[model samples]
Target: MKSDRPSHEDFPHFQTLNTRWMDNDLYGHINNVTYYAYFDTVVNRYLIDAGGLDIHSGPVIAYVVSSGCDYFRSAAYPQVLEIGLRVTKLGNSSVTYSLGVFAQGEEALLACGQFVHVFVDRARETPVPIPATLRAALEPLCAPG
Candidate 1:
C-alpha cells in the first residue's frame, strides 16, 4: 500500500532536520510518532521566526485543532530529512498547513501531512482573526490554485 504523497516541490518552505539516534524503533526505522514532532517543529519555527508569533506573550496564539499524516516509506536514524511546508488554506481564524518529509536531497516523499491551527485570544481562549503580520508572513507560502 504505497501512498501517493505530495512531492517536495509542492511546498514553498523547507527545513532540514537531523534524525536522532533515539528516534529509531526496534525495527531500526524512525518511529511513526516522531514524524508528528518534525511537523510541529517546522511549523513553529516558521511562525516564530517569520510570522512574529509570540509563543510566550502574545495577544493571540495558535492552537492545533487537527492533524494527520500519511507515510510513504520508512526513514532511519542518522538520515537527514528535508521537511517541506506550505499553507493550503487561510481562513479568518484558522489556517491549514500541508507538509512533506523527504530524505535530504531526494525527490520522493517519505511522508505527507496536514495540520490545522486556530488562532485564539490567549487569555480567553476564544477564536480571533489572524493578526496582520502573521497573515502577511503566511501568504507567500499559500499554495497556488
Candidate 2:
C-alpha cells in the first residue's frame, strides 16, 4: 500500500547517519528523544557543509527555535538511517525544514519532522538576515510552492 506520508522523492537533500548501541532504550528501540537528535544532526550538518556555517567563529549563528517529530515506525540500533530534507519555508532570518527519517535502503518514512532555525548575530543573539552564501545554499533545498 502507498502511504500518504512524505517520501524520499519529496526531499532534495540527503544525509546518512548510523545508530549507536547507546541510542537504544530499555524497550530495545531507539529512544523517542533521540529522533530529535537525528533531526538536529542532519540540519546542522547541512548548514556547516553546504551553508558555510561557522560553528566556532562565525559572525552569525543559527538557533533552534522550534521542532517536532512524528514516528511511523520504531527504529533500533544497528540500522543505518537516512535523512531526507527540504525547506518548506524560507524567510529572511528563519527557515523551516521538513525532514524525514528512513531506514537506509527503505523507501518508507520511519519518522518525519519540522525543524526551525533562526539566524542570529552570534554576539547579540538577535535575528539577522541569513548570509548570502548560506541563503544561496538553501535555495536549492527549498520545495516549490
Candidate 3:
C-alpha cells in the first residue's frame, strides 16, 4: 500500500539517526520494529533536552497511545539513518509527531510514520496539559507543513 507514496521531502523537519548492529534482523537488514524505536528515541531525546523533561521525577510525563510506520526502502546494519521529525498537531494533552527515516545523507526517506503521545500526570494515570517548558520547546517545531 505504501509503495506508491511520494518522497519524504513532501514533509517537514529532519533528524538524522545511525543504525546499530543490534538493529539488524535475521534476514540481515534492519528490523521493521527498530525504526519505531529510533523514532521514539530521537523525539524523546530532543524533547528531554530542549523541553527540560525529567523522566525520573518530573510531575508530567507523556504516554504513547498510538504509533505506526511505513517502509519505503530497506536499511541495513552499519548505516547512518537520517530521521526527519516534526509536530503535525498539538492538542491539549496529545501531540502527533511525524518522522521520516533516511539513510545517511540521502534526501529521501526509507520509512515514515506518525507517533502520538498523550501528556499526563504519571501518578494519576490521566491526561494533563503539556507543561509550559515543554510547550515552549515544541513551539519551534510546530510550524505548519
Candidate 4:
C-alpha cells in the first residue's frame, strides 16, 4: 500500500460504475469482494463492447484464470466510481488487465488490481489464440513501457 498507485490517466479505457446498497457490508462500506466485481465489470464490459466477445453463444470464450485486488481506501454505497482499465500484458491466448477504482475526476486510486483471462474454445475448453477482432480492440488499452 506504500508504493505509488497508477494515476487515472494511466488507463486507456474506463467504465463508470455506480455502487449499490447491496454492495455494502455490515460495516457500511463496500466490501472487499465487491472490488473484484468492479474489476470484472469493467473488463468484461470492454470485452463485449470493445472486444466483440459473445458471452452467450460464441465458439470462443474468455475465462478468468486469475484475479487479485489491493484496497487502498474504502469505497461506500451511493458512490459513483470510475473504473479505469489498461492491459499490461497480452499473450497469445491470455491477457492481463490492470484496473483501478477511483472517485470521479480523481487521480488517486481507491483500489487497484489485476485480472487475467484466458481465451478458450468453448466446447473443448482448450486454449485458443485470441480472436483478431478482440485483439485489435484490446491493443489501444495496452499501456506502453
C-alpha positional error of residue 40 in candidate 2 after TM-score superposition, expressed in Å: 1.0
Better of 3 and 4 by TM-score: 4
The C-alpha stretches of model 4 lying farther than 4 A from their native spots are 1-3
Tens digit of per-residue lDDT, candidate 3, span 2-106: 544445554555566778899999999999999888988988988888899999999899988999998878999899887877887888888988888888767
| TM-score: model 4 vs. ground truth | 0.95
Per-model TM-score, in order, reads 0.95, 0.96, 0.89, 0.95
Candidate achieving higher TM-score, 1 or 2: 2
Per-model CA lDDT versus the true structure: 0.93, 0.93, 0.83, 0.91
The TM-score obtained by model 2 is: 0.96
lDDT of 4 by residue, 1-145 (tens): 5556788888988899999999999999999998998888888888899878999999999999899988888889899999999999999999999998998777779999998999999999999999999999999999887
Per-residue lDDT value at 123 in model 2: 96
Error of 3 at 49 (Å): 1.0
By lDDT, the better pick of 1 and 3 is: 1
Counting clashing residue pairs in each candidate, in order, gives: 0, 0, 4, 0
What's the CA error at residue 6 for candidate 4, in Å?
A: 0.7
Ranking by lDDT: 1, 2, 4, 3
